[model samples]
Target: MDSDKDSRFIPVNDTCNMLEMTLSFPEQLEEAYQIAEKQELIKINHIPSSIATIGMGGSGICGNIVATSAIENIKMPVFSFRDYTVPEYIDDKCLVFAISYSGNTIETLTSLKALLDRSLRNIIIISSGGILEQVSQKFNLPHIKIPAGRPPRASLGYLLIPIIVSLGKLGLFNRYEDTIKEVIKEVEALRTDVNADIPVENNIAKDVAIQIKGKLPIVYGTGEAMGVVAERWAGQFQENAKVLTFNRTFPELCHNQAIGWEDASGITDKCVVISLEGEWEKGAKVEQRGALLDIVKGKGIPVLHINITGDGGLPAIIRAIYLGDFISIYLSALNNVDPCSIGGINSVKERIAPYIDKLNLLS
Candidate 1:
């Protein structure tokens, strides 16, 4: 079906129109920033000793991005978790952002309740509406409400921008509002090249999708900034492309994963490496990335290196994500799957609903 060049096949393959959502990402970022800017700045009397963001799956990923982007910028430690339990070390002095797009994710609710139980007042809730909004109202907790109905994965801008802008307003991060403005412009330009209307002859995203379409995709992030992006790319491939994908950070993977590649030529043939190389990465990590790609190529595996392009930490991360997102959607077209159909996840959710009801942790 020449998924990259044939426009007719796109509609047939992507019945749910995930391409439209991907196209709107640039706009989403702008709108998200405006929404966040309009909110009254979060007021915390004291500088938090640390910051933690908690959630699972799509919603949880924003926390990872926040922590990673803040690594070199913020003085306080930042942590992100996808588990039901909050880390014991996160005392009342820690600021917590509890994210749940649906506001009913059992794990998030449980963890938020845990924080409340421990008398943690430095809590901010972000959700579209649901149990989370209700809980916020019940407890008089600060809540940032986002527009509802979009899939949590598709709401990355709305999910992430509020946290960044709020923290920036409180002097925790610098140049964030400006950085976001640049990101919007970069992504808007990027979207033109990656969007569905662009053909394989000109679209890097489509070309990359064709290269890795049938192979297992393993995303490697060159550093902390790209590492979170690597995770997001893998997730997009899973949900949008309906494929099993994995992600690992550079030097760390060089130590252990490289060893597996040495003796696994047979399996290597079925895989493609998509390395998210950050321009901001240290030369040492860049060298490691090149070496790692060479090792994979020696074993006859295909390698696709995506250079992340943007002005700074957050901007670069967003640009990479925007490109990867389009690539994932194109890959979905090749796979002939509806990108929005998450039947497996929905089935699991159905099975677990009763158990969550029984627990009644929110009450």
Candidate 2:
């Protein structure tokens, strides 16, 4: 009758087995890169003046990461839309990609419909199978299909590789292939430290889990990679550890979050602040993130510093993600909580079914 025996909590060994599949991403990247190179050879009649990716949850987070990473370098403005409608400025000159891992995601579907209505210049679809795929076929829009079965969060590689490849094909960036290769090497190396075989004494993730036990985690990051990586940590804590956590980006946090911390005395001691550090060129805003961490620590919050290691931008970000993921899983084990079950989310879905039916009928 013990819940720990439930299949949902797949044993650590099983989770490690699953990691093998997830880790195949590096190989997948090579294939994706080749496909993208071929796609680049095919000349499209027209290209959009701007780009936007529409999705929700993990799907949306990927878009945010890409947008932030490319914002400073991309010739056209890149945007991420989490809502049901495309921005007003997204006209015929816009390339709108609907990205939904489940394909049936309401927000993404709605946004896709809106973009179609506007006769957007170019449209791409990324999903497994659902109404999104059907729409893509109906309109002859370009689409990428990902294998189904794994949880959306666990399929980060499938979701991200396509985006990276697509952008490369579009001539948006020339360094993606090398960057991806470097990241893969870095991530493979990290497996030794984060792998299940590594005992708690020497495992960085296990060490982090022990520190964060029973505390409210507040993750902070800077720039595109670290910021999205921070958000990923918060999401992993919620889904994998079933814990309440929050995340905010640097520089921006200084504008508001710094002041709010003053009144949080009761929770200060119980809070664990994780700062994600990355390589920055001269004068980059991230250079000052360490100062922000010092300020938070001075306010009595426990602080943990994690430096994302790698020469390439993509690899550094991936390392940060894998570390956070391992930490979340270990934290769940330390807290004796199931890492996979989300009964609460299922119950909410059940409660909404009746209303959803009624709305469908009205529509």
Candidate 3:
């Protein structure tokens, strides 16, 4: 049942429609797979020794996942670039995915220009359409087009799956559709549990929102496993809930950030700590996170932990990410903010129109 149809506390979501998109993540993944299958990518006879993806914000997340996943799965070099220029190590021999949810992102365009100037032709574009599409047509480069309209963050499947399929096409990834199907199942299950229509008592996300209300959220996760997911949670909290959020991973925080918490005269009460749970090294009984929990609780601060429910695969990662997304949305409703509105970003773009408004992303 769509929350929009229910009159009980979801009227705000009815107007925004983000709740629908959030709940439809499984369908989005299916749509991405279908679209990727239909895409006609240019043939690359030899798989490049390295891969890099350039993007920012929502589009950049695809690259982050690729870079992180590649570290564990791929022997070759892979990187996700958020800046205007590619690293010196990336040359014509390296394959690049120029991703921008709105194809007009000036940074990505500028980076693409730099690549072209370097005569680097091994690049593919993933976007809905804008200056990127123009560049794609002008250069006759292959491009993948996804649906536009909703927020870029909500279109995770559109931005992510093409990259996955392209890698499979290049023989870099072995399980393409199967991996996607598994995640879709997990997300489907997650949606039912976290839906806005679900009551607060049974909904973990709703429970989280209630607990962290009127407090800053500081999320900590295992560095290698959930760093990107932590960042995702922070970004969602910032954009959807219109709140300041912080994210850090383990060990590194143990050495420095934990000490700062010792003298929490003014900071401890204002913040709620959420430690995203994941597997730790074998025989490491007292994980740094376990120690940090005692440290925070000793200061009389609130600390909570959440873990993924599925097998530790892409499904687990996506499940955790989806949970955070709902928490942010539910928190948005709690704070009376519109989840779909991005006034800060829009104001900046509007204010800088003369210098940065050359391309129409919707076109």
lDDT tens digits, residues 1-363, model 2? 123322222335344344454446456556555544554232346666777889887788878867766743366778889986777898876766778887877767767776776776377777887777787777777778777776677767767777777776777755777767776777677776666667666678878888998999999887667889999999989987888999998779988886787677788878999888765523647556766777778888889887666542666777788888778777776666666666787687577545333323113
TM-score of 3: 0.92
Count residue pairs with overlapping backbones in model 3.
0
CA deviation > 4 Å runs, candidate 1: 1-4, 8-15, 359-362
* Best of the two (2, 3) by TM-score: 3
Candidate 1 achieves a global lDDT of 0.83
Full-model lDDT for every candidate: 0.83, 0.72, 0.81
Candidates in order, TM-scores: namely 0.94, 0.85, 0.92
lDDT of 3 by residue, 156-186 (tens): 8899989988887777866766777887888
Ten-residue region with minimum lDDT total, candidate 2: 1-10
Better of 1 and 2 by lDDT: 1
What total of clashing residue pairs does each candidate reach? 0, 1, 0
Candidate 3 lDDT for residue 119: 86
Q: Can you tell me which runs of candidate 2 are displaced by over 4 Å? A: 1-43, 71-73, 281-288, 348-363
Residue 137's lDDT in candidate 2? 74
In angstroms, how far off is 152's CA in candidate 1? 0.9
